[model samples]
Target: MKYLLQGFTMGLAYVAPIGLQNLFVINTALVQKRSRAVITAMIVIFFDITLALACFLGVGAIMEKSKILELGILLVGSIIVIYIGYGLIRSKGVMEKTADVNIPLKKVITTACVVTWFNPQAIIDGSMMLGAFRASLLPEEGVNFIIGVMSASATWFLGLTLFLSIFKSKFTDNILTWINRVCGVVIVLYGIKLLYSFIEIVKGY
Candidate 1:
């Protein structure tokens, strides 16, 4: 029970912070159907949970075995995150259009997948850090820990979506631009952390 609380707290600390994914979901809620954003959240949650499970199942051994692979992934993920952050920082428009719109389900799914999968830190965070954390708990506590992480994920996604949906009308190009900038900055920090970790891993190798 204590471990479960710890896991839940750690999960919230890891995920509750605003990032690219959060901004994307918020934007989706403002422009597209709210369900679209919820779907995106579900996709991300599933990916995260899947990776966490892998880490819990000793996938960290593989990650630890190949320092070169870790370095490569870290470097690549850092670069991509930095680029995305730059784009977000310079973004001028993020508001919903006044025009009637129809967003295709395929595009929604594709966008969600690309955004979620392209993030290298997402894999490391889910499959390694959180997963490893889960591994440290007693065997009986493992399931509770997983449930805790999942709960945090669910709480954040649903909370974000619902909050944005309610006040979606308040979003303007300027407001969204600021939100993007903030999220961009946070993401860039994550990127920098990834790069630093990569360098450390490479040095150890």
Candidate 2:
């Protein structure tokens, strides 16, 4: 019980940050159909679970020891994130009233995967925080902790989607456009921050 609570609290804290993954999910929910948004949410949750498990199972140790790997990930991930943010900022308007902006399922899934997996912050959170937490638990307690983390992730995504679905009608088209612009700016800033961090790491070597 204690381990479960600890894991849940930590997971929520990590996931609650407004990063690329969360922004992607929220944008999907706001622009796409409810069904499509749900699918995207599921993909995000799937990756979250996979990452948490990998970290808890010692992938974090490998990542920590490999500066080259970390640098490569940060470089590519920052570029991808920044590119996506630029696209968002360049878009003319929101598709809130129409399905014109609805992209194919494959593209949605692919983007979600990229945003979730290639996010440097997400990688660090899963590897450092989750791994460190797992290291503190007994073998038997590990499963409970994992379950708690997964539960928190599932709850957060679902709640986010649900909230968006309910309030989506309240947002005007201009408001939606502004929201997109704001999210894009934030994402781009995060990408730039990741790039700067990567450069700092490289300089140390």
Candidate 3:
């Protein structure tokens, strides 16, 4: 129970940040239908849990040990995150309506995977955070801890979707555009942080 509560709080703090996953999920909820939004959130949750489990298990430990691997991921991920942010900021045609966007379910699935699975910063951070926690716990508490993490993911994403759906009437096109712009700026800042981490790592070598 101690581990369970700890995991839940840590997971919430980790997932609450406005990173790529949150941006994608929020965008989906804003422009997509309620049903589609729920589906997208669910898909994101699935990939998120998968990544979290991998980090908790051992994948993160591998990265922690491999300086070269960590450096490569940090550099590449920083560049990609910055590029996405730039694109989001400068794009004139924000996805204003579901009718205009109409992203396919298959595409959504692929994107969910990409945003969660292939995200370098997420992988590194999750490993650093969850992996450390895993090491500190009693071996038998692993299940409880991970279950707490999974529950937090479900709660946050689903709650976000529902919140957006209920008040979606208030998000006009202009407001949505500004929200995207702000999110883009935040993402770019996050990328710069990752780049700084990469530099700090290289300095140690």
Candidate 4:
């Protein structure tokens, strides 16, 4: 129970941030049908689970022990994040009439995977935060902790998609455009922060 609570809290806190993952999910919910949005959420959840497990196992150790590898990951992730953000910022305004445009499942899954996996910030968070916590736990406790984290991810994505689906009609096209702009700016700022952090880390070496 204690481990469960700890994992749930930590996982919720980590996932609650308004990052690229959330933004991508939100956009999908807005544009796609409920079924499609749910599919995207599931893919995101899968990545979350996979990453959480990876960190809990031993991948985090590998990352921590290799400064060059960590730096490389950070650099690549930051650049990709910046590029995605730039594209979002420059995208045309969302049109309600086009909201139902049929996007292929392959494209949706691919995009979700890229966004979830390619983001360095997400990798760092899982590895550093969850990894440290997992290291301090008993093996059984670690299992419970991971379960708690997975539950959080599942709950968050499902709830977010449902909420967006329910209130989607209330939001005007202009409102969605503003949302896109705001989310884009936030992502860009986050990318810049990641880059800056990388530079600082490099300076120490």
Candidate 5:
């Protein structure tokens, strides 16, 4: 229980920031039907949990041993992330009776995967934070601790979905469009940062 609570709190802190994952979830909830938004959140939660597990389980170590592999991932992920941001920036943000023009499921899944697993910030931060915590845990406590973390991810995403749905009416097309543009800018900046990191790594070798 102690480990669980600790993980829960840590997890909340880890994911609470207004990054790609949160922005994606928020936009979906704000623009889509409740059922579709819920589904989107569920997909995001699955990827978030898996990504957290990968980070906590020494995937970062494997990448660290191969600079080429790490650089390749960062480069590819950055391009994709930047492209996603461009799409968001171009989106019309039409919400209301016509809000049913939903994104395809496959696209949603792909976007969620990219924003969670392929996101450089999520990768670097999760690896540093959760990986360090993993190193300090007793073998027996690992499961509970991670479960707690996963629980936090679920709660936060689902809660955000619920909250936005409740107040979704408050958002106008203009407001949603502005939100999209802002989030797009942030995501593009993240991609640019990752690209810059890739160049920095190249400089070292």
Candidate 6:
């Protein structure tokens, strides 16, 4: 029970904050292609959960084998985060609005998979935080930890979908720009946090 609660809390912490993907989904929802956006969001969540499971099971042994391995992971993760943050900050453009648009489900899924899975920070975040945290619990508590992570993602998706649906009519390019800018700031903050952790690791070495 305790482990489950902890898992849920940790999941909330990791997923609740505004990030690049969150902004992407939110903007997608505001557009006429809500279905496509929702599908993309689901794809991201699916990959996140799968990676979480892999990290939970696969990385524990590596961590135990060598402290350097763990530090290296963190360093690499921090660099990726910083690079992503820079991209977001420098990004300047608009998503072209289209009417009578048709996007294939397969294409949407593929794009989302690339965006989510290719992100090194996402992998590290899941492996180091969600994966390791869940493994710390007893066998019976596994369900709860998984539940927590799933719940966090589900809640975000549902809430974002609802919000976009409600305000879809009011959303405009300007609103999207604002959302993107704010999300950019949040992403930069995440990058800074990651960099700080890397510095700590370096100092320890």
Candidate with best lDDT: 5
- Deviation (Å) of 48 in candidate 3: 0.3
Ranking, lDDT, top scorer first: 5, 3, 4, 2, 1, 6
Clashing pairs in 2: none
Local accuracy of candidate 3 as per-residue lDDT tens digits, 1-205: 8778756865765575556787788788877789999999999999999999988888435655776765776677677657656765764434334332258889889989998999987887677556545533456676788888899899989998899888976645575456556656765665676678678768878
Q: Using Cα atoms with residue i matched to residue i, what is each candidate's TM-score against the true structure?
A: 0.58, 0.61, 0.64, 0.63, 0.63, 0.59
Off by over 4 Å in 5: 59-101, 169-205
TM-score order of candidates, best first?
3, 5, 4, 2, 6, 1
What tens-digit string does per-residue lDDT give for candidate 6 at 38-81? 67677767866676667666775565467676666555555554
Clashing pairs in 4: none
The prediction achieving the highest TM-score against the true structure is 3
The number of clashing residue pairs in model 3 is 0
Error of 5 at 83 (Å): 28
- Collision count for each candidate, in order: 0, 0, 0, 0, 0, 0
The whole-model lDDT of each prediction reads 0.62, 0.67, 0.73, 0.70, 0.74, 0.60
Tens digit per residue, CA lDDT, model 1, 103-176? 56676556656556677776655555543443234456767877787777777777777777788766566775
- Per-residue C-alpha lDDT of model 4 across residues 1-205, encoded as one tens digit per residue: 9889767755765574556677778778887889988998998899878877886676545655776766765666566656656766665544334332256888777777777888887786566555545434567887898899899899989988898899987746566456556656665665576577678777887
lDDT of 2 at 66: 69
Model 3: CA > 4 A from native: 59-101, 169-205
lDDT of 4 at 203: 87
Name the better of 5 and 6 by TM-score. Answer: 5
